[model samples]
Target: MLPETVLRTDDVAPDIRFDVWREAMAATMSPMHISSPHSSDFWGHTRLLTLDDVLLWPVAMQASRYRRTAELVRKGDPELYHITLVLPGSGRLKVDHSGRRHLSTVNDLYILNSSQPCDVEVEENELAVAIGVEIPRNNFPPTAERAIGRMLGHRISGQDGFGAVLSPFLSHLVSRNSAHRPSDIPRLKRILLDLVTGLAARELDAEPSLCTETRRRNTFLLMRSYIQRNYHDPGLTPRTVAAAHFISPRQLHRLFEAEGITAAAYIRGRRLAEARRRLADPAQYTTSVQTIAQRCGYTSAAHFSRSFSAAYGMAPREYRELEHRQQLDTELRSLAPPATAGRDPIPA
Candidate 1:
């Protein structure tokens, strides 16, 4: 069964909303310390939405502190993980999760797993957006410890570089008018996981894990598979292919070099070969040359004809006609009566 929950707190008062959120969270998971600026009455709005087990929340906060201890916590243990993001104002964050500590500022993100106790304190009024992703610790692919814990708190600001592109993309997705379809959940999760893992590895200087020969080869194979699966799209190009693989143009070129071909030439040749096979099939007599070309990635029928003539010494239509005639000739010969030179079959 799929699980989805959405919470919007934009209009509700901060304290009242937090209280309701605390009770809901506590019931769903464990107990935790939830507070705001003691100096002033905090005023803000918040929204939380969960789609098929994934959660998204955007909150405008005046300032707050949230914590979960072991004593009164659910199941006699602390929460498993707390993932938070700061959208506005400046504050500090600290987590004591694994006998080690992680600390950051407002522009930063903090991911803390709650096998142990910890505290997060924000000092001033600010708006924040976050998603608390709770998954069993063992589910994550084991890598260097540096890549562990909540990840979005690192360098993804959704403002610059990869983060810049991703941040606004997510912000717009969570905006009031947007509606995410359930069918898109798989793709959404895949993209989100890729972005998170890539950013974490980059920030922690853990690229060696992803840059290993085996890993690179796996990526190469995956891209090759994707191309093979989508070779029929006429607009396929090096740039689009590279973007799909999350690599730069230069890197994509190098990948093709390692595989022994130029990207564009490879895709073009593969598509042409598919067209040629279709042309050779006697069963394709009713299929038009333009239909074959379109199915095999040629945008212009005339261009496909020219290219086919250059490559195979005949236009696609002519090739199919020739193939069909040859097949009929062969069938006629097979159906003809045995000549004197032919031996008669012996009775079994």
Candidate 2:
């Protein structure tokens, strides 16, 4: 139940589609000058997902230029920072901000400020695709502002370290579309903010200016994010996890006290949930249960089966077969219509 809006050129007359598209883009994002060779009968479609105070926009359109002119910035400032990630492509996406042009790469990210002038253009491709998120610049903690400032208009590698992890999370998040629950959408602000915060802090070697309570909260979030990314590793125990973060296993235990669950228990629960998801996925119907279990960090099929039976009241194989049959029954009842939901409007 994420709050989202689908924008398209089809809603307006062909001759005025570009004007309407520009208007909609400005209204949803910020004031900008948009131009394209296809402007006469421009074709563009995008989905905008509002996650708390932030916005996730996956944009698809014919090659176009978006420019936030200095005059426009002076006219009105939204005080937002826009970050965009372009997937691997034969074409190129370029961002010109602060008198410099940064060439986009397969897993490259760049940020633009609404309070400043910038120009973005897509070239050498029939169609351009990118996922962009707009976050309020004020969200950056004062202590970390300098480091963040230094990053403006520079390439942030979505291929390395925190960027690598953050990129996948965003790619998956957008792929989920409106299938997420309402609660899930609102909670995205904290998760995205935390991940970005950690990435910035690590990259810039600047610590956030936060109180003891805030530090603890952020640390907890960072630890959870790390676990989610590394859950498939068989060596992901509390001790190793703590060591990775420069904390003691005892400290990690203390961190989870608020949730009324132990770190080990949380890890196990995440693994089981992942395994169950694979079992129910129609795409993995041919995948063996043993392979799925091993991929989920289960070393022994027998142990995985027992754990699955205890938690889900069925063996892994049985659960997979049950889901497969239920899918067939659904198809039979509905005559196997095309999928109507859970699809990304802008493919990665």
TM-score of each: 0.50, 0.84
The digit string of per-residue lDDT tens for model 1 on 1-348 reads 123444444455655766665565554445677776532344544445544444555554546666766654544753344455555454555545444556555545545665656566554544344534443344346672347553533334433333443344455556632456667667665554444455556556565765365345545545565566678998888888999868897888888899798888778878888898888886776788889999998899999999889888988888888888888899999999977746777779
Clash count per candidate:
12, 0
**lDDT, each prediction:** 0.60, 0.81
> Which candidate has the highest lDDT of all?
2
Candidate 2 structure quality by residue, lDDT tens digits, 243-287: 998999999999988668888988888889999999999998888
Error of 1 at 335 (Å): 81
Candidate 1 lDDT for residue 146: 43
Please give the range of 10 consecutive residues that has the lowest summed lDDT in model 2.
Answer: 206-215
Which RMSD does model 2 reach against the true structure? 7.3
User: Which regions of candidate 1 fall more than 4 Å away from where they truly are?
Assistant: 1-18, 25-30, 37-44, 72-81, 89-103, 124-139, 144-146, 149-166, 176-179, 208-348
Q: Candidate 2: list runs displaced more than 4 Å.
A: 88-90, 177-186, 208-218, 282-287, 335-348
Query: What is candidate 2's TM-score against the reference?
Result: 0.84
Best by TM-score: 2
